[model samples]
Target: MTQDTLNILHLGLGSFHRAHQAMYLNRLIEAGETGWQLAGGNLRPDMADTIAALERQHGEYTLETVTPAGERSYERIRSIRRIVPWDAELAGLIALGAEPSTRILSFTVTEAGYYLDERNELDLRYADLASDLAGTSRSTIYGALAVILAERRRRNAGPVTLLSCDNLRANGERFRHGFLAFLRQRGESELLHWVEANTTSPCSMVDRITPRPTPDVAERVKAATGWDDGAAVMGERFTQWVIEDRFCNGRPAWEEVGAEMVASVHPYEEAKIRILNASHSCIAWAGTLVGYRYIHEGALDPEIRRMAHDYVTDDVIPCLTPSPLDLSAYRDTVLDRFSNPHIRDTNQRVAADGFAKIPGFIAPTIRERLADGHGANSVALLPALFFAFLERWHRGELPFEYQDQGMDPDLAHGFFHAADPLLAFCQDLTLWGPLAGDRQLAHAIFGAYARVQHFLGRSPA
Candidate 1:
């Protein structure tokens, strides 16, 4: 394929995609590969400026990989052929999706973009669905996809693949469910049928710790390349992407470039979500409570590190399905990654969207443990940390501003004020859900929070 004809549209032009997917694509291009180039779509309005900067720079940016020993930077990232702002460029994105040359439509739109509800199901209640239903010029990734799929159905645009690179478990299935639900909600069952029959959503697990670049890192990149890179990304040296080989419109031989396209991505996704991600959140909340800034600082604290290690090995791993690989070794590597001194991954970054993330990353294991006749006494510490954070939120002790998502500030405050009554409150089957209402688990979580209060010396007034 010629340069102009090569097409791949990536949603969510975030740092992680820059370091992971874009980096992998760069490797492919350097090895003389063809028929693959990226066109990024930034969903957020503020990101339009970054997209313009990258486009002006000919889609080149710096990728800095920070290891414990030192840092390694890559300057040329020519795989990205164009940048399209999601709102202003919706027509372009839809056109690319409808193009015969466009085979892969990949997304790293984070967990929120999937519009998942409390049960981790497809959340059609999202406002974007209503907008799309009304035939408005709404420009959500989901909205754009709905429009593109509708056009594809009309044109008989052949089969296409949708690859989800988010942290959601069974990501492809989740995407398919969301897409079909959107179509059905819009009364477009014909389009839904076409999508169900022709489209493929491949499950994938992508791992990397790419933090938004700091000003110092930005200055370094500018000095090295003589170009002002506002969108430079900083990450750890480790990167992995495991995908299931289920694609409708064909895919690049990504497996040749160190991507593992397995027959099943369940094991890989489960392993990463339960182990790496769960541990990361555990450290994020617990470490932040103890006044640690970066993950490395928390890892260096013996008490925090031991707590994280114990939580992973004793509680989290026991509830998981047995893996073919050495999980212990994997745990060790994760700990090393967290302890990478050069990477300043902040607690607040990982700790964001806890309400949405914990249900997937932490709650599944909690449920599994409870089902297996195992008391959640050890696991209770995780929720206790969350409760402590909630208590902090109630007291306005948190340094950064956070948008409250569906969580009632009044309810959170009441929980903190009635710490003595928390055990009974937690027993409220509605708020805690069925899992937390289990007497044994509730008692354990209550006890753990009591301990936390004792350590902190009095609840927030």
Candidate 2:
């Protein structure tokens, strides 16, 4: 640690960050790339207890990983050198972002946190987003980054990279646009000018099945590593990060530590988002409807597995053909990752954000297929699965409490209690975009919904 050390100030301090991005930095440091380090924190107090525990341990935590074969391994992750405490004002995070030494400021906020509409514009209907637009708080990503970049500009901090490690397709480009739109709406022309010249948000695709830490994870860590680590996290052995390599400031030697620094992240992201993420939602929704609690159960079930397999094999792979990677192999690998029982990825976790997942993960394939004059029958099952899952939540029958950032309770209830719930769902512009009112889309989804009802042993109403 010296004046020469550079930093990556990360925004989200969740399990995915702890097990994925932070681990990459740790590997680089272990390989003797000592010039770069991580200073991680959160924008909100959602994980105050985890942050406090991380600070107590000086930002060191144990990561437990398991393979599909049931073999387990543990590694001590010491990449996060500083754990910035959460504050309502985000004062400490803003100061770190304004530092020229912080070459890259990355974030892992969930996909729903962006609050972008189908048109890629900022959706101010959200209370947090509206409050941020009114300058009442710095809670959302755009709001937080606006103030950070403004302060950095006032202090004359040099150019830095704004990296996004989320599941959104073309995440970096999408975020850059949404962020600039936020500034334009805020009437910060001078600050926007500085941001346009000073920051680069390169698209990146990150993958790792990092499950929410259960009490068993900590007990296992204590048994295996002899450390009482409250900050311990667990994930699948497979991990990946493909970046667009457009950093404005200098970056770490990440390529030396198994990360792919590509000229473009388009192909990689398309495969990951469509095949892995979309299928993940499909399984989660289908699994939850059929009384399954874990993702592995759905991935292992013959009928549920076929639903996901058919969606990728029938709809997605066709659209993504002529790809750099083997689409079929990639699809199989993703399903195998989901079937790892030790990860215990919950249906509740994966099934929580359908409102966001529909537009982001599932709808693109439907749009492409419909544009090519093909019916979206296979892809329709995904939204149908979601509809059945939503019905359970509406009836207060879900085994666990559902959490959706984009869902409106009254709106969802209206959908279920409407004359035709499926039609009402299809007409939600936020979920389907231009395809919202298409008769073909409606027909396909209705048929799929009936099929879902039969699968769940209930007759369609």
Top-scoring candidate (lDDT): 2
Q: lDDT by residue for model 1 over 1-461, one digit each (tens)?
A: 25346577887787888899988888888887866888777655656666777877778888877677776665567888877755654676777677777778888877766776665555555565566657774456567788776776677767788888899889899878877776777788788888888889989999999776788778877777776787788889888999899988777778888999899988778878888887887777777787777888877766667766776787777765477667778888998899987898888888776666666677777777778877666566777787787667777887666543434456556665674646644554323556655776777777777766664563321
Error of 1 at 321 (Å): 4.7
TM accuracy, model 1: 0.91
Model 2 stretches astray by more than 4 angstroms: 458-461
Per-residue lDDT for 185 in model 1?
A: 71
Global Cα lDDT for candidate 2:
0.91
For model 2, how does the per-residue alpha-carbon lDDT over 1-461 read when each residue is reduced to its tens digit?
35588999999999999999999999999999889999988888888788889999999999999999999999999999999988889999999889879889899999988998888878888999989988999999999999888889999989999999988888999999999999999999999999899899999999999989999999999999899998999999999999989999999989998999999999989889999999999999998888889999999988889999999999999999889999999999999999998899999999888899999999999999988988788999999999988888989999999999988888988998889898999999889888898898999899999899889884321
TM-score of every prediction relative to native: 0.91, 0.98
Clashes of 1: 0
What's the lDDT for all of these models? 0.74, 0.91
- Tell me how candidate 1 scores on lDDT: 0.74
Quote model 2's TM-score: 0.98
